[model samples]
Target: MGTESSVKAQAETQIAAVTSLSTPQEGQKNRSSGNFSVENLPAGTYALKFVVEGANSGTHFNVMKDVSGGTDPTIWSHVYSGNTTDVQTDRSFYIANPSGTNSNFTVKVYALH
Candidate 1:
């Protein structure tokens, strides 16, 4: 029984750690034009949120497709524009593993007025 309890406790601790680590720090920004990776990502669906700084008013914001590892990333389910500027916009994608292997990916956000 003690062994079982220990295993359960360890599992709970691991779950907590993963939940805390999976979430990117709020207000984090990536300004470079290269492949950015999310390490130890839980295998499931996730939304990639971007906060566009310096976006001009009246321009449409597009979450461009991913262009890394020769795989094309799809656009978000919704489009952002105009008054939705300078905020965290989210787009969903799926991951199948949590290994260190980087699912190398890139995305470009553009203005389309």
Candidate 2:
């Protein structure tokens, strides 16, 4: 195989470790999961995946990135919004929340490249 083809093949076979930003829980509307630090990880775009599991129907989710460090954290960016899953990319992220009643959900963060 050519050099370019070899690199592409390696990347395709590599599996990124999935980090759970928050455990599965019954989420409340407008309630934030709070700021999480990805400072230890390398600087690269990451895919934030949110999955709604259990008995929470009609539940929606949203994500924010690079929240301010303070008593009241400010959202730097709103990267995602959906009910089942969000594959939005961001280098830094802070919060993920559910916006419907009885929201049993979880958010998984994984590096993309």
Candidate 3:
């Protein structure tokens, strides 16, 4: 196959491991709050994007990326913690991806503070 074809194949394989959040469970901490996860991600950086539809007044959501260590067979290290804001009016944000194998991602929602 050609180089372009090979690259496209690799990208497809990587994207296959990425999953989007279909449902967010209401958090016990707050009634307006909720959480969701993107599970079974491969070892690479992924762009975390989201869209919030039908949000009531004073409701907002944020997508955060957290990562653990990929080195050493021992303890895991928290490499990064970055967040993107989605105000009720804006309703969207793009957060950077997590880097590591089997790392988990979460989206948190709450009343505008």
* Candidate 1 Cα misplacement greater than 4 A, ranges: 1-32, 40-48, 64-71, 77-113
Q: What is the lDDT of residue 68 in candidate 3?
A: 32
lDDT of 2 by residue, 6-112 (tens): 66321111222222223333463333564444434334434333333442455544455543473433342333322222344344554444445353344444433
Tens digits of per-residue lDDT, candidate 1, 19-61, equal: 1111122452311122233334233313323332333322222
TM-score of each: 0.25, 0.39, 0.24
- Identify the leading candidate in terms of lDDT: 2
lDDT for model 2? 0.39
RMSD of 2: 7.2
CA deviation > 4 Å runs, candidate 2: 1-29, 43-59, 65-93
Per-residue lDDT over 1-113 for candidate 3, one digit per residue giving the tens place of the 0 to 100 score? 47776653222121111222323333412111222334343444233323233322222333333223422121112222222223222222222222332322433322212
lDDT for position 33 in model 2 = 60
What TM-score does prediction 2 earn?
Answer: 0.39
lDDT of each: 0.27, 0.39, 0.28
Ranking by TM-score: 2, 1, 3
Model 3 ranges with Cα > 4 A deviation: 1-3, 9-31, 42-45, 55-60, 64-113
Best by TM-score, which number?
A: 2
Please rank every candidate by lDDT, starting with the best: 2, 3, 1
